[model samples]
Target: MNYAKDPADYPLAAKDPALFVHQHEGAVSWGAVFAGGVGAAAFALILLTLGTGLGLTSISPWSTGASNAKALGFAAVVWVCVTSILTSGLGGYLAGRLRRRWLAVDADEIHFRDTAHGFLSWAVATLFTAAILTSVVSGVVRTGAQTAATTAAASGSVTMEAMQRGNPAAGMNTWPLGYFVDSLFRMPAGSPPPATAATTGSNETPRAETARIFLNSAATGDPLSPEDTAYLSQLVAQRTGLAPDAAQARVTTTYTRLLQKISAMNTAAKSAADEARKITIGVSLWLFISLLMGAFSASLMATYGGRVRQL
Candidate 1:
């Protein structure tokens, strides 16, 4: 009879500890983690680039294209969320399925490990993307700063040349003090006004003064005073060689137009600010929600992938 035919002929391996020894290893697999992270980052980058191209195609520099900023912003938000979900899910699934199997581990422990792998993959991918964006932004900012510096230097040289030509008003048009300086030399109501040649040259003194008055009124959120109106009317009459009543009427009409423009500008600015605030809030909320959803999606997909691998 052969030894294999007898039930008690073979010694049990469990009877000797050395005969069937096992060694446990770490559960975390760096190779799988890296692969998952790189995959997620690449997927995200590709999608983002495609989305940017699509956005650029939709916008135009001229008025002919659809220029609805709100719609564009909304679409961008939606795309970002979608990208997060897709890339995160794929990364998590890859991580789970590729991870080394943990033999003899508890089911609960395996589930926790899968979830951890997914979260870690997402975190690594997010950091990698952030690093790339930061590098790109820093490069752009550095280039812009250099260009601006060069432009400012050139402008400064030209300004200095203008100042050296004995023309006090050469660059005064751009200076806030020019308006106040003009006011200091105002002639009394009954006094003869200065010659047109003296006030009108290339100096732009009167124009600067007028602009300053309008700007000040707008900034203060107040209308021009009666005294200022009268003064401006007198100046207009002297400069235009018109009768007092005609000059006064022209001044009133011009001032009314200016006031309307200022009011419209204020309204537009307020509207822009409100729009920006809303967009900021919306983007923030969407980002948070998308990230939360990405986390959940990643973990769930990871577990599914792991289960499939086991099967």
Candidate 2:
């Protein structure tokens, strides 16, 4: 009756020596890992979508919208961290609780296996989320590129038709090289200004040349030369039918205004870049911290879940 105490007297136990040997199945449970991973990814995606909706609600196209970019970025970072903690904790708990029990295993090994399951679940969930996001972003970018290309082709065809109909200025407004061509055929100050299409061939060339000059000045951080200023003034006088002194004053005023605009644009660009850099750095740091917290939470929760399951 008591086989442990009387194995020698038991006929079946005496006939089979292999029956006493203990066999260990595999340590890792892929099923539990996958289940937890899927749950975590789904939960994270739902939370992120909700956060996006909330964020969008706070923003508006009108001037009255909450447009503080830095504040929005900070809130996004915080939300992501919170999502990670909650999702990872839940996933780890499920993994540990759902995993099949190991017979005749030491307490230390059980703890190690529980922690490993939690970590693996977190890794799988993170990878799944990243893959989904990458695919979505790639699809959006591809669609946008195709739409832009089609629109550009259509606009180009329309511009060519306008040029054929003798409207040279139709596309010149968007051309950066038009300014240089305009300067090549500058009219003398005393010449009669062309008032109509019949009198003036096309003002596109002159306008283009002016744009090139301004672009060059902006790029090189230099003012127009004295000779260029004089020549431009003469061109203005002929084109606008103004006195020489009046044309010169107008040119000077225009140059001053352009310089002010360029300065303001440069200042705004630098400010934006600085703000973006700060946001990027802050987000990266917070993300790293959040991931660490997630890992800790998941491992701790898994051990607790495993203990509860044993009970």
Clashes of 2: 8
The segments of candidate 2 whose C-alpha lies over 4 angstroms from its true place after superposition are 1-23, 60-71, 142-200
TM-score of every candidate: 0.68, 0.73
Which residue pairs show collisions in model 1?
none
* TM-score of model 1 (CA atoms): 0.68
lDDT of 2 at 112: 94
**lDDT tens readout by residue for model 1, 105-152:** 567988998888888788777889889988999999999999987986
Cα lDDT for residue 104, candidate 1: 46
TM-score, candidate 2, is 0.73
RMSD of each: 9.3, 7.8
Runs in model 1 lying further than 4 Å from the true structure: 1-24, 58-71, 138-203, 212-218, 225-227, 308-311
> Which residue window of length 10 is worst by lDDT in model 1?
157-166
lDDT for each of the candidates?
Answer: 0.68, 0.70
